[model samples]
Target: MKRLAVSLTLFLVLSLGVGLLVSGSEVLDWGIAGGLFAIAVLGECFRFWIRRTRSKKRDSSSV
Candidate 1:
């Protein structure tokens, strides 16, 4: 439940940021949007890799 709420909040915030970038008519707007997108992607990748490594460790220790 907590994770769901957090995810929703992040989604809304990111959506707003992207919407602003789309509506605004400035180079800086695009830069901000691109930077935010890259940051989010990198964060998700990092979280995935960490979860993968931790699961591997848990599986090995159980044997």
Candidate 2:
């Protein structure tokens, strides 16, 4: 249940960011929508990677 809530929250935040970018692009350059989405995903992946590594280090240190 806690994991589900976290997943849902991330999904909603990503969707909101992408939706805004796509919608706002209607007035500017629309081609960058895909690029923006890709960049967002890349950033998120990097953040997740950092978090995972930090947690692993912490867990190993405590054991």
Candidate 3:
């Protein structure tokens, strides 16, 4: 079940990627792609911040 879910998600992403490439000229000048790239970077930064905060709290509580 989990594998099927993962595979479907991968398939969808790949399809979207190929579609984008095929229609590149239509959206090549649009900055939406850049915004998505920024969002991905920010998402990683937020994940790191939350993990660090949780670890710090756990360490302090152990004392």
- The candidate scoring highest on TM-score is 1
Best by lDDT: 1
lDDT of each: 0.69, 0.64, 0.60
- Regions of model 2 farther than 4 Å from truth: 1-30
Ranking by lDDT: 1, 2, 3
Residue-level lDDT of model 2, residues 1-63, one tens digit each, is 565457656765666566666676365443454565556567767777998999999889853
Question: Over the stretch 1-63, how does candidate 1's per-residue lDDT look in tens digits?
Answer: 566457656865785578586766754465666667667657766877998999999889953
For candidate 3, list the clashing residue pairs, or say none.
Answer: none
Candidate 3, residues 30-52: lDDT per residue as tens digits? 35544554555566567669988
